[model samples]
Target: MYAVDSPPTPARSPQTPPAQHAKPVRRRSQREARVAWLLSLPTLVILIAMLAYPLYRMIVLSFQNMRLKELFSGATPPWAGFDQYTKALTDGVFWGVVGRTAAFTVVSVSLSVLAGLGIALLMRRVHSKVRIFMMVAMMFVWALPQLVAAQSFRWLTDSDFGVLNYVLTKLGLDYATHSWFVNPWEGWTVITVLVVWAGIPFLAISLSAGLTQVPKELLEAATVDGATPWQALRNITLPILKPLLTIVTTLSVIWNFGLFTQNWALRDGHPEPVYQTLATFSYTQAFGRSNYSYGSAIAVITVLLMLGVMIFYIRQMFKIGEVD
Candidate 1:
């Protein structure tokens, strides 16, 4: 070999990895992902148990001819397919109840929001002590259970011994012992009032929070620009409050649309089928008539409606983000 001095070969090092021998970055990322999922496993399990499981069961029940007798006899409830859904969708009474529910929700939500807005505005203008009292009163009412509130309505409207009847009698309305439930208007009025009252505190508190975010400078500037308070509210306050309004009203619709405890409790004393809202109607079919599948179908429809509200709420949140 021509001893042409080959350049001294560089020493191979143990510390530095060659390009082909590099650590697996993707492997590390996958491991981190697995660790994160493991950490969240408990919450995932809870949600599956509480929310997902029931939803799955309901959907299953809605498609099958479920009955208490079938379960007790250990007999399989056959797949009814769309029979329950067909019945629910075709029933004139069901459709009427749905119409009433929509009207009820509209009235209750509108009045509650308006009342809350009024209260919020008044609180802003009132002395601190008066504002505190109003807030406390609203909170106290909100703290009452819906069942208890419904019972209170019953007591207040009792034909024989109601406080309201007593007051009306004292005011010289001789027919003050009114069978309130007999009249659709009166029964719905009580329900509407209950829903409105129940909804006001949340709406008021939220609107107050919205109010805080509204710059005083804007109001003052509007006044400087010769805008009346009403005009300023119509133009500036409402535009700024659109997001809050959308959220509150949508939530209220969801809550009121599916109201069960209060509606059931209020009508328990009488049990009028005509007085049924969608929630009570579902209850009637499920337990009252032992038609579980049909009830579940109704429940599925209600869930779909609420899901629409949820989707609306999420879209609104995204829109707000884009605006910001």
Candidate 2:
């Protein structure tokens, strides 16, 4: 009989791997990814509820012409279509306030940074007990509430019964008894002094922390090479601390830009347009004038401007990081 023709065995491609018979790896990878997202779901929800929600609401409110009266009235507020933004951009008073705020931020932040750096440097060489005492004092000052600090400043600089003037009078400097909160220059002086005082402690503490991370040998080597203390600090300490300095300075700028309670209290409720910052301006518009939408626009603008400045500083910090 003719050899029985058997059905030819299905030819398997030689290039095909035996592993192809196993389950798909992609499915496992996707399952792992799902598990990861599930694990992080709580944190994501918290962030969305806190940061993202407020930000979204603020942006939405900015485009609405919602006045204060309608805030609690449950009305469908009309769309403003950038009307408030246009008004704020064109308003001379708003521009003036912005200019003043910029100047204030620059001067106040500079002074705070310089003072804090100086204090930090001094702390590095001080006795243990002295350092502890200094730290405690600074912490106390920093811990004081803004309202209390502002009030204390008012009392300390009071025109008539102020302790500062009383001491000055004893020293025969009668001019020191003049009011510090009436004239624009004097008021600003008082405000700057207080703000700088309050801000220095935090900056100094952060700098001190960064200082400890610096290699002591580098500083010693610089000194051994006939470098003066200042030269050693400039060449060694500062180079190492640049990233930290950028971070601290950026934070100070952010804090100072929105200085409200201290400044508002300094004005003693007689807030003038000349001295108002974008923050105070927003508050006045929202609460004082009951113009919620316009105030929201101001708030949005302030956040954008702050973000712009912060991004510049953060980029510098990241550049340093990359170099390292």
Candidate 3:
């Protein structure tokens, strides 16, 4: 047996699965990617044509003196070389407009989000029938066109024959034939009220939807542990709702900061310089005064401000995703 024994046959290295086996999978993935791109192509094209081109044109216009003359004559606008920006930056009135816009955004968004959160919490505690009715009413308001709402508010606040003044007069507050717009403060109050009223439905509904995701079990356990409703909300429910709250808050900020319809409508399509926001201010400069390049520059700045808000929103969303 020893004489017959031979060196053990060299062990064969383990054969790898053939690389050929991966080729079809790789090809399929490539094919799927191609299909996905194809599916997205139309949307990409539309966005580029609609958003990108207009943005590019606006940017160019911001750097050029393009008034009605240039616009109508189809002539190339003279290069402005930062003059428009300088003018905007130097103008105290422009700064005032910016400040007013920021202030309104803060006040309106704060009121909206707080009121919305309260309403959402209330909805949770209400009978199902009541909840449904509230939702129906809010949905009706939300669906009402902004223009119509603004017009209705205008009518309600009208000086000569306003129901508001009539009611206040009836209550002996001496509001008979009171002009709401005489004082900028009063005008702004009306505008803010209308904006807040219009905005609440969206925020409440969205926050209510978010609240449904809060775990009943967790809330029950917290209750069992003798945690107060506030403590439970602050600790448990808020943490769950934080992401949605952030998203809605950011959107509200964006919408309120722009602030066109309510202010414009309330002011009768011609907001005074005192009531002007960035949006209306730019519009007044461009169309009302025919200072196109200056208006474009302001518009550019507005877009940048919005971009900052969007960046913050995106960062919050990313953080929320990581937490999830």
Candidate 4:
């Protein structure tokens, strides 16, 4: 009997059922989803009513042979397909305007960003009171309505009664009072100056914020390593500030491309269309000549160009982020 006694076998608990193991927790119900959609219906409807209709109308009008007469006579405009687009492409003035717009954007954005960076750096070192004063002055320039700024600049650069001419004369410089708006290059120069003046403040404020994020410790370390201020800015500050720079430059390009008020108020369609950007050209086509279809075509092209630029900008920004 003693030899026959054996160790007792260990008992195991039963395994969980396959259904219990595999089952998922309850999720949102169809009814709940439907309720959420119902709550969002007003925003959806408003977007369709306000945005969708206009966009659809614009696309439809762009493809039509609609003119002022057809619009007024209540006649259904004939479908033109790509005729308007072809015409726009072949137009010499369109190309000229494109070139002028590009030039203006490049010059204005370059100067504005550069000047803004300089001012932001300068402000970082100055007394708080001086910085505040400079900021106030910058805001004054920025707060001047675009039209008023354009007009004031025009008066200041006038051929006859300009302060510039007076100043040059007073300084004993042989400066002649030339017609600023008469020449194509001169007209663009004036527009560029006004744009840069209006735009630099925005860049300065934005870049200043970015500059503040740069670590003071890193800067001090660089200085202790015998790095010059310029070297520190180049090697340390700029790399940290790249994202903000990209944003500022991209926004500046977009803004300058769509610029209307400064160009319109400053030159007022002078210099035989040489100073016209896409915005002004579209306006002249739509309102000046009542060519609705043609105007829509121009607008569509401008929109496409802007879309392309934005796409590239976004791609570049993502690439920069990835690099970091």
**Winning model by lDDT:** 3
Give lDDT tens digits, candidate 1, residues 110-214.
999999998888888889899889889989988999889999988988888899989988988885667888888988888888889889999998898788878
- Taken over the whole model, the C-alpha lDDT of each candidate is 0.85, 0.87, 0.91, 0.85
Select the stronger candidate by TM-score from 1 and 2: 1
Q: How accurate is candidate 4 locally (lDDT)?
A: 0.85
Give the alpha carbon lDDT tens digit for every residue of 136-201 in model 2.
999999999998999999999998778988888888887565886668898899899999999999
Top-TM-score structure, candidate number: 3
| Clashing residue pairs, backbone N/CA/C < 3 A, model 3 | none
Least well predicted 10-residue stretch by lDDT in candidate 1? 16-25
lDDT score at residue 29, model 2, on the 0-100 scale: 59
Per-residue accuracy of model 4 over 131-202 as CA lDDT, tens digit each? 999989988988988889988998988888899878888899865676777776777788888899899899
For each candidate in turn, the TM-score is: 0.84, 0.81, 0.85, 0.80
**Higher-ranked by lDDT: 1 or 3:** 3
Off by over 4 Å in 1: 1-48, 321-324
Instruction: Give candidates' CA RMSD values in order.
Output: 9.9, 10.3, 6.1, 7.2
Give the CA lDDT, 0 to 100, for residue 243 in model 4: 80
